[model samples]
Target: MPASTSKSPRVAVLADSDTRWKWGALTAHRLVPGGRLDGHLLRGRATPTPRQLGEVDEAGVRPDSVTEVTAAEFLATMARERYDVVVLALVGGGVQAMLHGLTHAWRGRERRPVVVTGYVGVVYEKVTDGLLLRHGADLVLANSRRDAERFRAVYEGVGVDASAVVEVALPFLGGAPYRPADPYTVVFAAQPSVPAGRADRAYLLERLVRHARRHPDREVLLKLRSRPGEHTTHVEELPYQKLVRGLRPPANFRLVYGHMGEVLDRADLLVTVSSTAALEALHRGVPTAVLTDLGVREALGNHHFVGSGCLVSWDQIDAGRVPVADPRWTQRNGVAPGDAYGTAFDAARGRIAALLGGAGPGVIAPYYDARTAPGYVPGLLARYHLGVDGVPLAGAPRADRPSGPVRQVVRRAARGAYRHGVQRVAPVVRRLGEL
Candidate 1:
């Protein structure tokens, strides 16, 4: 355990959105085994609102402090605090940029924080591309045994070190087995970008309305990730909340917000097009279904559940059909049986201990650099206002944290504008340009 060191190791988790923060914060506790932690929310289009962070924050593992910062400001903090571990709970581009950024930030230093990065959910798309961008982390977490194997294939194929990929279950899985509440409740876990088209989202909403009408004795909850003007890990072009505006559903049907775990407390059945919530439900033995109503396409992401035996349609469910997930499938995909979760993080902890236990921390460079990826790497770093050398570009404004009530209002307004641009402006502009 940490080589019996006198000083408790420090950890920093830099997350971009609400869901990532939930995964990352819990992961930090598991990695260090006994160290307190701090959080950094990257200033971006998808930064979590106060309510979002509040819902994800756990009792014991909540960071002692949380700071909002941009790419440049984060680099400065890393150098100043000298944390023992830094978790890059970000998108692939953010991780890649931060890898280079940290290399420069820790240059010539004897010790550097052991960097960790990984996906928060099922890796259905961009398998190789995502793996490559996340290559340099000292621990790249794979949420299942299957995930670890696939990760090795991609890295070993490209002559990159695959040892960093560690097998660990999703850190957010903890809930009692499903027990029926007074009224059977079915929750449709909505994703921000699963069905990107308005018509598709509306269709799903309409079907849920039909279900609520047909089963008046049942409670149907449409679990949403964000409110109207807020954002999540992905851009939501057509949010289910927006699509439900024109629907007249039964009184038993409603929209819910808060922790998915808390919602699962009363849920007898959970449904989703393609959400990490499906895994959470299965972990708790809640009856879960991966909807094939919209066709199990890769774009829809239900294809990842092809052999899970939990794939069924709204029509079948309407006919009182229940999909029983194959037990073997669940075990292979990191959905360990109930009560077996405590061991899931042990492997990750041992790996971190070995790194932080031995000689002073070492610096690891990313796969991409100015020379190896001349056409690509520079532009990616520039998006974060960082140069190819991983230093702040000249004239980049300082990203000091904003405070005071007036500034808080301004921050919310800015977030609203950014969401409008992503959901409303960018799509129209793209369509027009194509024409």
Candidate 2:
């Protein structure tokens, strides 16, 4: 199909978190350079952190144009001003429900926008969540060929057509020129909330701090996921600051917070329990280590690093032994430069173009279509759209206030309880079972 001769396609990206917004912003940036696209960002129920807002500004997404709108407002905007495409950079139950509402609101409309959705990072778990999101989308983008294949199997198991799934490279891998780091700079990319019993965040930080002490000349940077008081999806994270308090970390040992690319750029050796940052480090030719001292295989998602030869332990880091990543594993996992994993920027551009140029309104799953009308009011009132204190503008009498902010508070409390139980009570139960 030829390019539209009239005007650029109007695109809107709905994102929940900073990292997720990056995926959308990178895609939007790629689309704009083609001179045939106009992109805007919509703040979902999860408000953007200050760092995320900064990132959007830096990505050339005009701050004036970014809108913080309710789900009803989003749907109203879509209804009033038809967009060519609406990309969802969201996750979990919130996303699944949003997709349902969007499809329902647009049902039978002559000018419905294409719905594009996908996971923000490598999909290690939550297969069901991924499937639910994909089922209602016009195009479901996968992070790699391997991921695309996995999605196909999942779709097949559920008896849904898997033709909509397409493989695209990780967006962050593009355009950043790799610069070598200073000698003996080891960066531990911290993810404080892994599945329970997989890895200990404090233990990992302690080992790295200890290693830095053993070799005072080396710099050890603990790269944090978010700054203090910043909103993030990790509800149960134990901040690295809390973990290292009173240890009196050496001057050379620092807690850093910035872009992953910049962090990896200055890392001579990148250490992680099971972070996608390892893949980025390998892409930049940094010596990478997937710490396996605490857990192995699926427990810590170290299976993905198996053939990479980058998996290591505290002893190895202490002894100044950093294992080099295998290029084969890197290539297979879609980190290596090549067509095997389509270039993220280029793939995004082409996919959007194809969706716009193709005939018909695109596929709308029967499941979402059937649930549209019945779900409109409740979906509009759902927490992702309305704050816990918010009420519908008019019409039907309010049953009970459904505010997302209140639910978020409740969810966080539950997560705290769960984490506490897992840490304190689970061990005793396991010991009793062993006896």
Candidate 3:
């Protein structure tokens, strides 16, 4: 890389792994010219996926564009190369690390644009690029406007610049529309986070099987979604035999694994708890029932039956006969399908464009339509504690001491320890080897 006196907006994106690197590379290729695109992947020991390798090969992005390095390594590169913008796609603890480093680097130089994608599962509450922006993220592109607004609301007191919050529709949501035969068929969508119904999921599966058995003539469907390598991890634990043993399963009780668009075609009702699949079902004019707890009910508000009908609790399903598809929900939420879709799309795009430093008319265009994400973060955090997938604590937890100075000292000390731990370990290990 040489210092040329030019005004082109060159960007350096930080990816977590090769697969992430490929996505960043492709996005840059579409948005920025070749010479302006620079992609750096975090130096993780994880092996590159086949699809990732394939994407890299097809894209023909040079090896120079995709270097493996630590956050510090990439930060040094950004400083040396002088990137105009930085797009960070890493999630979880990686998100915090990127924010810390970028904040430090930005403090010393001219302000550079910082945009991050927030698509991780809702398990980690209050942890997002939304949180990063508080540290100094120029823009945080949420998957939807509802999410973007929620981000703004969540960080209201934190003092992050609100203008930089945008919501863009996720690339995966570009699925085909779903239309059922008579709006009477029902589909139970499966999520990766095993539903917390009954002590054992097998018991719940048995209950669902019994429901299918009772309604032998009605169409019953089960659609499951998991990541590329998660099939084996999730499936082996599921009780397939007991759940499907006795009765001849209904014609609609099909096991859907991938590509939700195809399975949603004949589904009149979609059932799930806290899965974004419900949003997909809503977009496709299918009624949805979130059969979990009251928390989900509270987050989504009362209109469960929009394009679809919603039943909050499993007991409500039996009492209300939700799979039957209530007509009121359909009429209210799905009155004018095309017009509604266009409006939702427009709202999402406008919010996203505004966050990304763009303006009104162009932001609301069809190509940038962002859909709302049906996620409840507070509930997720309540269910899953912070230690495993959250910010690492120093000597003592933050909750133990709420005083400003105490908390700040812990955070600063933790950061210092993390930064120097690798250096400290090298010498002691070398001395032990001599012994």
Candidate 4:
């Protein structure tokens, strides 16, 4: 904790139940040990699994500190306690809870100190107003500096007054075990496809399997980490391992579960089709190939590892291998290029404290959508009129028009040829020996 003259400020950390609490909470503790940091687990759609519940129950938060609260309860807790700071380190879907807390403030008697913090990517900038700025977000924190800069650019471009955002890096384990030298290992962490990233995954995985077939002796290992509640719509429809089973690669495939860190520890080459796991592998001195280029080239730019190889496409995988020991494999310590995994919560707390001159913490009330009353479609639509809620909405748009006749014909021919090629290689994927 920073040396304080008076009693340390009490900080309440909002943690989501779906994620691991240790990393976020531990980091908060490093910032404030006696600061009354509490973890509030955001309830998910399903009942918490045994492991999920166990992780929460085992966090050892004091009875007063540990509470399973809904989005409504979060603002109530803030109002009742009027905490000095609220650190929000929630998962992808928990932003609503933060909005609820803000709504509570909007409706209630007091404002709560709050920091809006999370790992949400640029995709969320649409639904959230001013990316939580207009709703009392004072400071925004992200996972990397790059993301922070991106957030700032996007936020300011739309007139958000960017001074409120800060990017604090997660403490990545750099000296963690390195891959064993020699006998280069191709490593990839399999994510059950999600509709959002599935097309890229299928395209990249197909190309990877095709490449591996040419060098049957090369050792490649694909690992999948499964925990309950980690749902993907596509995975719910078609599980990943089933697809892996379909890819019966010859001599170079091993499927394993759990112990991902251990598995990556021995990998000399790491490949990710835009998975954050690539970052983890990179930290382990494994050369990372960020496969961000697919059909959606214009929508998303290539993700380049700083000082490393250019963002690679599936066709370039073979020629793109770089040595893990090269200087390009090294990255700066602390935050890379994104906003804090926990942005609004930390900002709310820190900025509120700043605004209040370290007096009573600023209070952030709850924000709610009337349930009994019909969903406020008009009220929601009004936000679009004001120009905040619909930012990210434009990123992924619907293309209703069918492909032009010529393009459709070309696509059909390409699909036929691609299917023929895949059929020719389908037998190859079916055997560990053929690869």
Model 2 CA deviation exceeding 4 Å by range: 1-6, 31-46, 59-64, 175-180, 195-199, 297-299, 338-348, 366-435
Q: What tens digits encode model 1's per-residue C-alpha lDDT throughout 398-430?
A: 746455689768777888898888888987988
Q: After superposition, how far is residue 323 of candidate 2 from its true place, in Å?
A: 1.7
* Top candidate by TM-score: 1
Q: Provide TM-scores for the models.
A: 0.95, 0.79, 0.53, 0.61
> Which candidate ranks first by lDDT, i.e. highest?
1
Tens digits of per-residue lDDT for model 4, 296-365: 2323322334345535555566764563423323333222322323342354345554654644334432
Ranking by TM-score: 1, 2, 4, 3
Worst 10 residues of 3 by lDDT: 361-370
Q: What are the Cα lDDT values of the candidates?
A: 0.86, 0.65, 0.47, 0.48
What is the lDDT, from 0 to 100, of the residue 189 in candidate 2?
Answer: 85
lDDT of 2 by residue, 76-148 (tens): 5565666676777776554555565565566667656767777776677767655655576777777777888
Q: Give model 2's TM-score versus the native structure.
A: 0.79
Model 4 error, position 360 (Å): 4.4
TM-score of 1: 0.95
